[model samples]
Target: AAALISGHEDAYDGFICDEQSVPAAPGEFGVALDASLAVWQQKGYRGIWLKMPAAKAHVIGHAVDRGFEFHHAEKEYVMLTRWLPSSENKLPPNASHQVGMGAFVMNERREVLVVQERSGPLRGQGVWKMPTGLVQQGEDISEAAEREVLEETGIRARFDAVLAMRQAHGFAFGKSDMFFVVALKMEAGPQARELCMQEDELVGVRWMGLEEYLAVPFTAARPLFQKIHAAILAYVNGTY
Candidate 1:
């Protein structure tokens, strides 16, 4: 016989299994899970959420055999979800927005940091843009901006403030994107003026005059880019 499984009720009248209460043996886990599902159904639970850590991956097959479907996964754990109700399942989807950060780093000489990507939409186009990258999990926007600037141009900078934000739908994999443009002041040191471009991702990294950056063909073509340029200018001029 398997031990009783315990869980808590969720806001949606669902059940969230206590991962710590999972049985050690796969057979015991299967028996406990089946009993829990039957109890939950009798209690009128509409959905069930179960998180299985990588260490307990062997038990995932048991959950699948009981009707749980993969919802999402991270490095340490995987989330499995199941709709218990016979009616239409109304559980919300996983994360839908990808957050990105752009760094507008400028030095005392008023030259802005820019990079020419070796790959991407601007590859081989001679278009220079601010260093940008996706915000990693558990990273702040400002920290991501600083990290991107450092990784792409080898320039250390301090985050000042967010200059602008842009949102759009129909991005990669049918998900939306939220882009943040942030202002950063270059740190004083020999590395500040040195160029050490990331070879694989960038063909060139250099500092260009702010006016020249704003006049680039790529910048002129996009209204949002022009707006971000204006915001950076305002921030530098202390009028932001």
Candidate 2:
């Protein structure tokens, strides 16, 4: 028997087949795979997703031969999906799946915190972006956002909410990068006291008015800056 999962907010409604769920029998895999797809289709699900441990290549190969397409992968598993009769069958925007976090912090004066990297491709290019970094292994996304802000700008902040998220393939050295821009409230009192730059890594750290930040000319990050500016506007207008 195959395990069918549904009613989950983050996952698509689908069925999963694997060693644990379906015991390995000589020709049982093919029979189970077809039966699961048939049941899901009969139940009116638009798509079916299959996830298997990377070690189960044979099982995954069978599903792939039956039209399951690659979706994404993780350290221990690979995800594959097949669209049902009424499904659109669109692939995810980025399959490489590198996750990153960014901090959009605003002070009480409505000024946005910005940073300039000391080194890397954009160093000294006059393009200022939010405090951002790739999330470390096993790290919480929210914690990663807060940590990145403190590391680059030396300004501690509290995560307010996730304002926006986007994915781009071949970003930052040709790797797929999924970026999350989170809203952070600058901590008050002693915590918010100074503009300390990570000297070795950042060229500058300062707070600028949202409008001023938006109006500044950007080199390669113009699109991203515009998106962040839009997110700020949305927050102010209570749309986000």
Candidate 3:
């Protein structure tokens, strides 16, 4: 018989399998996994977390056959989960927060970079807001902010400091959202001032005076927007 998989109990009374200890062969892995599951169940373990590296992917089928479900995956590995008891599985869901950022780029002329989104809630509403987008996996908020500014307006900018943050629930797919308002400095180049708006996602991109932007009907109507813009202005004026 194959040796039982090596692992330790988690704080939540769950067993976390050691990836390095997983059997390389499918047949051996199946036998070892079964033995481990039996032992865990006998010990009244609540859940089992199996981390399988890409090299041991062949054994993933064995874990699945034993009722393990995919929890999440990365480029080099996959995480499988199983609840030992028959009662409802209390295993916590994977990553619950979605991060987003808005780029606040201003020039010496007191003009801020703004974009007219071709789609989204503000589309066709004449709302000119700061360039914003969701942060990609493994990307930092500052990086996302600069990237959004560059992508939407074709104006290169360097990350400064995060001026403010807002959190809200009931976002897309029931995930919580973390919105970061980041200050960015426009880079020195001809492209920095030229307009090359992303046609698919933006209808227009331009530099609007701070007061003009803050006066937009949409911006003027929302207190949050009012405060956020005030904060950005304070940061630029060295008063923040």
Candidate 4:
């Protein structure tokens, strides 16, 4: 309400009431909408279209008093839009997923940017894998991906294409992981050239062929990577 009554006029097009967090009392359409619009009009606002349940028309009628008109109605919702002819439409950014985020470190490859971890849970682990990491709070998946890739392997990478999004399942030695199969355009070579191994965490970063990745003993992977590997190869061959 402060946004409507005290902010800049023409600052917004109209307000969208996503949730009726404040349900109106019975017989208060005029009391609610007209009063609200009057406050907004003072700021030079153009119009406001509120999507409320049709069952709440008594509260909507108040808007009609302030030049608000009915635009549409669906199920229990009625959309009332009032024009002040000056207000601009402003929308908030979409909410991010509630679940945690993660990314895949791709290498420039006509093939694959794979690695065999030197340390961690599978110590002396020679399993081929795509570089991936968990996103920390306040950090985007891409940012975390780059940081983790650099920390685990000395490879610097840019996210190319997203190949896969595995929900409901992923692997982790500590935190939960939401692996995004990202692509990195890279030339085939030694992964160690860019290896920034956190000696306590990883041992090696080896770039290898897709077939090699598939053939690495199953003992070197978590269930998530095995599936990711299958998905990746499907792309390598342009099959799936």
Best by TM-score: 1
Better structure of 1 and 2 per lDDT? 1
TM-score of each: 0.84, 0.57, 0.75, 0.44
**Candidate order by decreasing TM-score:** 1, 3, 2, 4
| Root-mean-square deviation of candidate 4 | 12.5
User: What's the CA error at residue 143 for candidate 2, in Å?
Assistant: 0.4
Q: Which residue pairs show backbone clashes in model 3?
A: none
Q: Which residue ranges in model 1 land beyond 4 Å of their true spot?
A: 1-4, 10-12, 20-30, 55-65, 86-92
Per-residue lDDT of candidate 2, residues 139-192 (tens digit): 888899888888777788888888888888987657787888888877878766
Which portions of model 2 show Cα errors greater than 4 Å?
Answer: 1-95, 172-174, 219-221
Ranking by lDDT: 3, 1, 2, 4
lDDT of 4 by residue, 60-119 (tens): 655565665666655677766655664343333222333343334434454455555665
Show how many residue pairs clash in every candidate, following the order shown. Answer: 0, 0, 0, 26
157-183: candidate 1 lDDT, tens digit per residue: 889899899899999988899999988
